[model samples]
Target: MIGREDWAATALAEIREMTTENFAAELESLEKRKRKKDIERRIIEGPKQPWRPTRHGPMREVILTVNKDWFSEDAAFFGDDQATRENEFGAHAVAWLKANFGDDVIHARADRDEAAYHIHAVIMPRATVEIAKPKAKVPTATATRRMLQPSIHPLIENYEAAQDSVGEWFGGLGLVRGERTAAAIREAREIGQTPPKRRYHAKTWKWRRQEELRLKADARALKDERLALDARVVKVQEREDEVETVFAVAEGVSSGAFVADGASGQPGLIEAPVAKETPPSSPTLDALRKRSPVGFARASGVFGRAWQRMFGQARVSAEAEAAAGVADAMQQVAEADELIAKASALLPQQTRTIIAKIRQTIPAIMRRLEQRVKPVLDDQKQDGKGPEKPRRE
Candidate 1:
């Protein structure tokens, strides 16, 4: 999340020439324009085409609209806030489209300036047998009349009615109402009827444009901020690596220097000394003594081998534990990715909220990993020791 100061600074830096009043005006204008453009793009692009069966019939277009009334007081449902009502609404819409329309709904935004803060989505209405035949026979005509038809499903009817209701609610809040659908408004205009006054005035357009620039500047600043944060994270990771090295060294020191009986037995600090001078010979005694030295060497060798086996096992265990931890982290990353993808598929208002939530959680996760890795690294560093040298035969 960006602080207010940072956002203000970036805004001031990007559009220093414009007065605060003018800037605000321009910002609002840009947002409205942007929204309009986005809607147009979705409509033109159409819904993603799905693979159809050879025996299956042609598809039909279904256009759906929602009235502005279903939204919150501040038009917060339409605004670019994280966790806003609009996002939840969009999610619901998409879910409904996919489930009821068999995933063939093409989403389109109508270019109707008469209805500001409105949405126009297109769906392929071939899911049920009832709507399928009409849709298939005259797909375009069916789609065009779907909004005006009285026999339409109650769910869709309610959604359309909610727009005017929402506008009335907004009017109560001292905000202008945006009630008419683009299609309805256009028909009135074509017939020489005086349409309702636009909620957005010239000043509003100016403010919207300014806000767009501010948002763009803020986004650029955010990109730099993210890069810096990533660098810091990398540095912290390097420090953790150093700490792990320390931990390994400390562990080695704690385990002692050498093996005595075998690789698995107690560690030996130093090797036993070899006799330099030969004693006067008693054949039997000499033989036994000779055997003693050989037995001692063999026992020590066995102990060394056992120690190695135990050390190897410890290393493998450590590696496996580390791998498991990495896997867990990866799983979380995948979940975060999924959330991001879902957010992206939504409208701008909803997208921001999901992204914000994801952003909020990242730092905490990073801190937790750093804390866990630090101690092990510290131990490794403190235990620093070199390998032992081989003795002469």
Candidate 2:
């Protein structure tokens, strides 16, 4: 009974009301147009429906945007020359839009609600499509009447030409066309591949809200993963430092660099960090080292090999690090424009620019803050800091 009577009565009623209200404006517009058409025809009433919009309509929308830096909240983009740049860009942008779009641009607005100046426009691409009137029953001397249907204009046929034309018009404004996009398109065309299609972020709450939620979720996940990784890294670092200390003491005792406490009538136990819980740390190693001096040396060697196998090849190579730093510096140098574009005017641009310029030239940015990063392999190598053990593999 409930299913037949009111399964979703509330929802259905709300949907019906919402849909009717949404189309109410369209109905009003159509009625006004119908009255005008009636006056033109000199008739009492117009057809029930004069025009109906099709799925594949002749109407199109275009959005033009200025660089966000131009309209900074705090300070000017070009300092005192900010107004000059804005005026120049605005004049050119308006001229370009009007000239290209003309009277066919039915609905157009310059929106400055955001920091950047942007134009929103709708283009009606109108053309004529002729249809010959059916033959009259009675023959006449005059030719048959013809009716013409509307069609889209040829101006918007080539999208690439429009893109190039806009960039060319704005060439003087320091705002370059999407260089990466153009390069990618050219590369694809040269290789006989289809050029990448341009994409626009949809300005709807439904999609944007979902995207925001997804990004937040991803951030949380990444943060959790980082914390877990940090914990593991801390454990590994502490253990490595302790193991290095043990190796140093063993080497000094064996090489007569320093005498062991046992030789001086002290305790026989070798110094090592004994954890509170029962944990394995080269379990067989301590036992073998207690036997003889030769046994101790062999046991340490065996333990070192075991550690290498367990840890995999995570050795710090200075040459590799240097190469990476050089590559980063070269990349920074090449993207000098990108650095300028990304910097906000709210902050001190001159200071940031100077810093970037300095960094771009340097082969590597020294990470001095991170004192934790040590050259584990280098210290073991010909540094004379520790014993030189023969690598097993």
Winner by TM-score: 2
**Residues 1-393, candidate 2, lDDT per residue (tens digit)?**
011224246434533553454344334443444545635453333332212365644356677776787555323445663555545666676677678866555555666654577776656553322222225576433322111112333346665667777888888766666545766878999999999975565663565688789989999999999999999887655443333333332333222232223333322334333423323443333443443344345323332332222222223334344345434433432343233234322235574464454334222211210111235534535565343355699
Q: Write the per-residue lDDT of candidate 1 for residues 217-330, one digit (tens) a residue.
A: 999999999999999887655443332222222122223322123333453212223322222331222232243443333323333333333333333335444445545544
Shift of residue 311 alpha carbon in model 2, Å: 73
Measured by lDDT, the strongest candidate is 2
Q: Which pairs clash (backbone N, Cα, C closer than 3 Å) in model 2?
A: none
Candidate 2 has an lDDT of 0.46
TM-score of each: 0.20, 0.32
Cα lDDT of candidate 1 equals 0.41
